[model samples]
Target chain A: MGTGFLDAFAQEYKQLLDSELRLLVERLDAPSIIKESMIYSLEAGGKRIRPLLLFATLDAFGIDPKNGLPAAAAIEMIHTYSLIHDDLPSMDNDDLRRGKPTNHKVFGDAVAILAGDALLTYSFEVISTLPNEFASADTKLKLVIEMARAAGTEGMVGGQVADMEGEGKKLSLEELDYIHIHKTGKLLKFCVVAGAIMAEASQSQLDHLSAFAHHLGLAFQIQDDILDLTGNQQVIGKPVGSDTANDKSTYPQLLSLEGARAALSNQINQAKEFLKKTGLNTNLLREITDLVASRDH
Target chain B: MGTGFLDAFAQEYKQLLDSELRLLVERLDAPSIIKESMIYSLEAGGKRIRPLLLFATLDAFGIDPKNGLPAAAAIEMIHTYSLIHDDLPSMDNDDLRRGKPTNHKVFGDAVAILAGDALLTYSFEVISTLPNEFASADTKLKLVIEMARAAGTEGMVGGQVADMEGEGKKLSLEELDYIHIHKTGKLLKFCVVAGAIMAEASQSQLDHLSAFAHHLGLAFQIQDDILDLTGNQQVIGKPVGSDTANDKSTYPQLLSLEGARAALSNQINQAKEFLKKTGLNTNLLREITDLVASRDH
Candidate 1:
């Protein structure tokens, strides 16, 4: 079940990221409700895939993954914030995520929305305030710039808006690609690119790593589409077919299930090819790409 | 009617800030609704007090206000985003802002929410990616860290949560101050501290400027509470008594109108004392403080 190195890395990081995240929010000295709402969502937990991707990219670059902890946590906070907002009643109206009641379901829409904002805003603070030992101030600035661009209108939020407007309408493959690329791919690409940036990877190296992430993200999304159709609710955490219920267009819905699976395989292959071109140690990166391509959840 | 220096500076920067802000969003190749929602709130406009404060602080420290344009615009974006979210149905539920329908009323809830998110995220990008001449990466990094701390849970968002939780409870003056300081003071304080930071002012200067901002912010909030009690609907751009109608606490509600006025006067005086201590070219900052203390809308 485990790709030995990847599993070991993830296991070590999950606890570190989790505890660090717990301390970050706990130290806020904020109102109890806001903290509770934030913690509830944070603690409900997911696969920590974004952080792992960040760590893998660092590992591939021969950078110590531990030094990237703040950036790792920052990206995960961003990923988590997006999930919280996406599950809002006005958005997906989702009641469950990660096998737990959504943020809004438990904390009410107002606090949930605020909790999301807090997490999003705090992510930058965590990164921006990192000591020079982690990364130079300039490097941190680049990370912040890249993160904001990826998470802002040109990225996740814009993609979310497009997703909302496109619901109940059949979306073309091009349109779906826009949604997936900006919605999910941009930040995923950021994960790898940020790792490269932190490690002072050259432009050539950054480009290859970015290309790897672009394909990996698409492959991951396609796999998610497949899992929604084929995976059990218990395994997937949320109920299956929720996308269809929300009138969302998925790859499997646009293409046949077999076609979607083929797309996934193609994307994964492209991702691996890019990794190979990076000409760096990519054992963890390759295994994670494989894991993403095959994960049921 | 005008403090000559403050008025000229405000007029100059207001146009520059507004038009620059317009161009920043215009360049974003985002989806229409999201862009529309963001611009609607942004262009609807307000005092632009935050930007003016940024410029005034720079002017005081003998730095080119033009050099601060990106940061000024960034802070305004953050202010606008906070307004958009604060006006959402799930939040303050206001339908009017700057004499126009709120973002949610114009673009619906989801777009409004995402637009706010987009604005907040992009603000950092604006600062982080500023050309090297305007500020160093370390300075930009500091600006981002300060902005996030002021705008995140322990600052505006936390204040917002407290505001929500305290509604209808006839909060004590101390409780009300907590909301005002976190909700309004933090960001206002950032406006000054960020300017000094960018200017590389001496520690003594930064301390005096921070103290000035602290008092000015408290005065500003007190005046807002007063306006909600006595100002015209058309002048204020929103209904008077909405705060009371929502059963929220205010300075006047807790301390009586006369007491609130006395408090506002005291705050303004304290602001001036700090400014006098700075002993820098802070005439513009002092005038702006006076303006905030007396502005009708």
Candidate 2:
């Protein structure tokens, strides 16, 4: 049952993301070099977790998931850009991501960097072009603000900086939480909340979704840590123990494996409780949360 | 008279930019390492050319420049982010910008890269937050599209790629034109067009501003090429002959000094003619055009 939910959700979201990315790239004008660079990494596969959460949140509000596609695409674009830059020779210096040669490795460092920059700027273009299917300008603007906050200084970028600065050093639980929340949690929150905002969900509903997403985000990171430590390279499709090789701190590094497992359980419970309050169909969300905690990779 | 215009314009724009940047940075949530990286470069002094162009265009339309502050700040944020990324060791590898260490040099490559990402994301946030003081949602959305096109694959980034690929190799004038227009011209065009769009200018007015800005952008870049060849480090605040050192093909390299001079003159004439059609307060815009051609650095 869990595998069924994961496979279905992943496939549907991937199809949606692929279509949206193609359409967005098609809208570019004649010059094709930069466009090709951008398309290269964007099409490079990753689990479309962020966009899935966004669409699911919208669906919970009885909103058509199509209404959330632009935001979905924009968040993925930002995510892909971050990955491309992070994998640069001067950064993580990784030559592979998801079992494929990294963007910089394939396109050269200059093209990879420019590709990241282009995608970051193009996300705003996606948000601004969102059709009037939105309930109000105020709501659309709110979604934009939420996304910017999530992606900007106080959010993912901040997290990445903290992670960089903290590498090869032991970090307290509080410090680690700070890094994860900003770096990964914020964008996840934006993914969920942006959908709710687009659908004009009640403030109360939004609050619940925020809580649910926050916990899920933490849970997601913890799982990533676990997979990094123990998963098979063939299944994970990225190098295992790469974090250890870099001397980066992770939940499993800070907390023992048992403690990390306990924390994961706690977070999963919090996500479930928050979702229950929404009184919406959360069967898929619940199953995904379980999958997040239980997946081997 | 022209010198006075240039000095006052530069001074006023600097002041406006300073205040806008302060407000923008102030909005960041408390104490994130990534925000620090962003602020490090954003506050470093550079010519506020893009924001100044935005404000000047707004001023020409009889709009209170304050109404356009969000757009002005947003454009600068985008420009600053591009500069930050461009200076990375993986890209242009410049250690200095505006007489200060580049962000990557001071903050480390990862932080610098993330900082650039933060600023790019924040630019859109600034735009979306424009209160009803600017215009309707449709108009604001239009501005977003214009800015995105200028910054994205088919615009500035595309130009940069062409530039990198064409480096050291001899290039036809058409290819060089392609690089300059897309890389620099597009964003410059956005500065003028976005301002006019916000001011609700007539279609004809927009067309005039567009043409004026197009020529002005090309002229500005050509002037940069000349400065790269002949200007002092103290005056330009960047190393002289850096382009030649990098084996970059510039206008001065592609066209002889005399040819470059004639091209600059022709562009200035075209820009002046376009501004003449607008019949607005042309003094500032006209002086700016002349300054582009005559600037020593």
Candidate 3:
């Protein structure tokens, strides 16, 4: 896999998104500390994979990816809120994320929780207030529906609950798959489906892209597990092997390390097959798939 | 202050909202505990004033209050989620709400937090997926925007941060009003505006109704503070004077008790004046406003 167009596309959009997200929060007549905490975690450097996927999906359809800016920012807010809440002392209790103090670590736990809640609530507001020129009310409503479901109980939150319950127990592959599919996969799929919606793609095209995202989601999580075992602490931004330390189940724990690698490869291949079926300019998506499968962090 | 019409209307709509809220949580295919936690708080027996206000607003427009059910449920969910988070150990740390153990007490902090997150997310989904037969996409989109703004940073969450920061400090009347208006007043106002939007009222009507709601929200919060200081613990469902115990400023604290009562009366009058200006069938709203001003809890 070559790091060709994805880097240039990502660089342009990531900068646009970073500023757009900042302005969105900064302009709110809210309390300063909460705004600071929200911007702090949001600016915390992750790969911005979810927003990139959304922009890339639009790019795949030969559309200007900037049209999806509000949706991308909304989705990133949801993702960022989940991370903030997940790192709370009551939850993952992590002190560092992306090599910086977690939201709760810098702000008190109370403010951190409120910051997450504010971000989650703001995501919907961002979409609902999208300008008429960007999308119709119908389109905005659809985006909100998709976003809410992907982040709510039937998706990421549900996955988090199941993962929490499955801790300290030997989990079956099927159970692990259920967790990953709902937790990580649903939102990734939403990113693609949202792009297709914005592009007014046919139902068949949306269906194929959704399938591509599903496989890509699992492959992404599997690589996450693999990276936990083998990636560097400095690169990954948190201590490696914390999943093992917590005695939680992972792809590498259920499947052997080599087996997890093979599964990741299989998922990547399946994701590519669905991308091919979409019959759009999927080169960007195809490259993203390879990156998810092989990312160092 | 006749209770005749308000009692009958309240009983019928309150039951409808309670069951509808339950069904909304029950139907999710997510984990049982999270669902149970969500439902537990939904059933925790508060007045359901937000939903009632919404239903009453529609009734004022001579529209069937039933048409407002989904939006009613959505607002109540936002209200309920805020309560759950407010009772978290990091925040208020209260064990009791409405005479029952708070959500975190029964479900644990982790599940309680997720339950709040899930409810908040689902509220947007509920509005976005409103059946086309009931409302047009334009209406739903507007409803989402109003609901999100009322519940998000500029409204409830912003108010919460201010309230949290003002704890154990001397707060001026202006500062206290700011907290009440944002923290409680915003969602309350959303209920009324949502009803007008759903009924497709004219901009003039919406503006009047919004002003009415603003005053009503302040009256409601002032009465809440009065109750906390003077009402019975059994009747109010929590200990009286928790506000004083926490060193939080209240209407009665900033103004003398007699002065607070006078202020409450002033707001109620202002709220009614706006309602009368709208020239709708505001009998129901007038009655509910009276009820809010005098409620023990």
> In angstroms, how far off is B179's CA in candidate 3?
0.3
* Alpha carbon lDDT at B130, candidate 2: 81
| Top candidate (lDDT) | 3
lDDT of 3 at B269: 96
Candidate 2, residues A23-118, lDDT tens digits: the string is 898788745767777888888867788888887787777777777888889999989988988899878889888778998888888888888888
- Give the alpha carbon lDDT tens digit for every residue of B129-205 in model 3: 87787689999998888888898889999999999999989999999999999999999999999889988999999
Residue-wise C-alpha lDDT for candidate 1, range A168-244, written one tens digit per residue: 99999999999999999999999899889999999999999999999999998999889988899989877788788
Model-by-model DockQ, in order: 0.88, 0.64, 0.91
Docking quality of model 1: it rates as high
* Candidate achieving higher lDDT, 2 or 3: 3
- Among residues 3 or more apart in sequence or in different chains, the pairs in candidate 3 whose N, CA or C atoms overlap within 3 Å are none
Q: What lDDT is reached at residue A136 by model 1?
A: 89
User: Which candidate's DockQ is highest?
Assistant: 3
Error of 2 at B182 (Å): 1.5
| Residue-wise C-alpha lDDT for candidate 2, range B1-297, written one tens digit per residue | 446866876797788778878778877874556666777888886767787777778778787777877788888888888889889887888898777889988878877887787788888878877887577776766777788889887888888888888887988989988999988899988988998899888999999999999999999988898888889888987789988888878788878877888888889999999999998886667777777888877
TM-score of chain A of each: 0.96, 0.96, 0.98
Q: Is candidate 1 or candidate 3 better by TM-score?
A: 3
lDDT on C-alpha atoms for all candidate structures: 0.89, 0.83, 0.91
The candidate with the higher DockQ, 2 or 3, is 3
